[model samples]
Target: MQNTPENDHEQDAAPSKTRRKKDMHALQEIGEQLVELDPKKLNEFDLPEILLDAIHLARPMTKHGARRRQMQYIGRLMREVDMRPIQEKLDSWQQVSVHQTARLHQLERWRERLLTDEHALTEFAEKYPVADLQHLRLLIRNAHKEKAAEKPPKSFRLLFQALQATITEV
Candidate 1:
């Protein structure tokens, strides 16, 4: 057959081998992430029974080669499944976790500042007007004493929990 524009266009319509490989790898990575999910969370995804069985089989695998083969099989099965919802759910969970982590860091900074800087308590009261300044002050004092005595950080934990409550309320 002669090389024609129509034939060339038809050929170009298919994805390149490199692109196809990348897609398969991406799906495989998604499968790996799915396998790491909690069993309850995994059930939230309407995955195929075969794929679920494959994932279950992979969970107890101790050997490298067997798990690798199972993962590859899961990837192949993923090709037939609509991956959009699964990807979206994973993305949402990641975003929530990131936000929660950021919030925890912010609270930790506040707690450290409260412990080290006397002025930080006033600043915190100013920022979170609803905060019980007296209770916070007492907790800070106890936390200092606990640290000095090298005791368990009961007050320290209480301060964090208090901060968590105050910040969350805001």
Candidate 2:
């Protein structure tokens, strides 16, 4: 059989249709993710008013069917807006969250070291030059005493707070 122009056009259209479907699915996934975000975080994105309203409306939807339908509506609205800025903001928020978690872990490690090792305080003060060496020393000593006496961990909490503040300022 001869390859006609009509046959070639049909073949090209088939791939385009599939690609459009994939794009729709991707937009729907982004919409679903937005719905799952807390309202405060959701407000960080520069979204269309209609899409933002849809998202807010979906939040109170307890019934699964209704929520799903609302999400589909959100996805439809998303297609009319530029998605690049939204995606970039989401990516940056995730990165900031990850950085905060890592910082918290580092502070915990420092607290543990201060409690377990005598030299840890010197190392911490050296690393965090702005830290009040004398205050940290007092807290660490009190925390150790509290641990040995099996008393409330007031000093331990204070030490952690001081470390957090010092690290955050840096």
Candidate 3:
């Protein structure tokens, strides 16, 4: 057969040995991450029982060589399963964690502002109309006294809880 553009295109389309190795290594890394996940979290993936058994089997192995081989076996098993949904779920879980962290930071900033600034309550009420302004004002006042007396920050914590409830409701 004569060399042709079509033949060259087919060759290019085929994954090279290096590419296959990289793909296998990536799958292996994902398998490792799966092994680290909690059993409950792992069940969410709905993996094949054989793969799940392999993962569960690997979970308790302390020997480095044995665990590595089990991981390789898991990777080999993973090759037969579609990874897109699993990867997507993992990514979404990460996104949820990031969102929760950001939300906590925002609530903390609000708590600080309310503690230090006189006008913060009014601003908070305006932003979150569902807030119990009277209750919050009382908590803030008590929180100030607690800070001055160096008491356990019960009111401060209550104030944060109030803010969380008020903010999350909206």
The clash numbers for all candidates, in the given order, read 0, 0, 0
Clashes in predicted model 1: 0
Model 2 CA deviation exceeding 4 Å by range: 1-21, 37-46
List residue ranges in candidate 3 displaced over 4 A: 1-7, 62-66
**The best candidate in terms of TM-score:** 1
Candidate order by lDDT, highest to lowest? 1, 3, 2
| Residue-by-residue lDDT tens digits, candidate 1, 59-152 | 8888999988888999999999998999999999999999999999999999999999989998999999999888999999999999999999
Q: What is the per-residue lDDT of model 3 for residues 82-115, given as tens digits with 9 covering 90 to 100?
A: 9999989988998999999999999999999999
How accurate locally, in lDDT, is each candidate? 0.94, 0.89, 0.94
lDDT of 3: 0.94
- Against the true structure, candidate 3 reaches a TM-score of 0.84
Q: Worst 10-residue stretch by lDDT in candidate 1?
A: 55-64
The RMSD (Cα, Å) of candidate 1 is: 0.9
Error of 2 at 16 (Å): 5.8
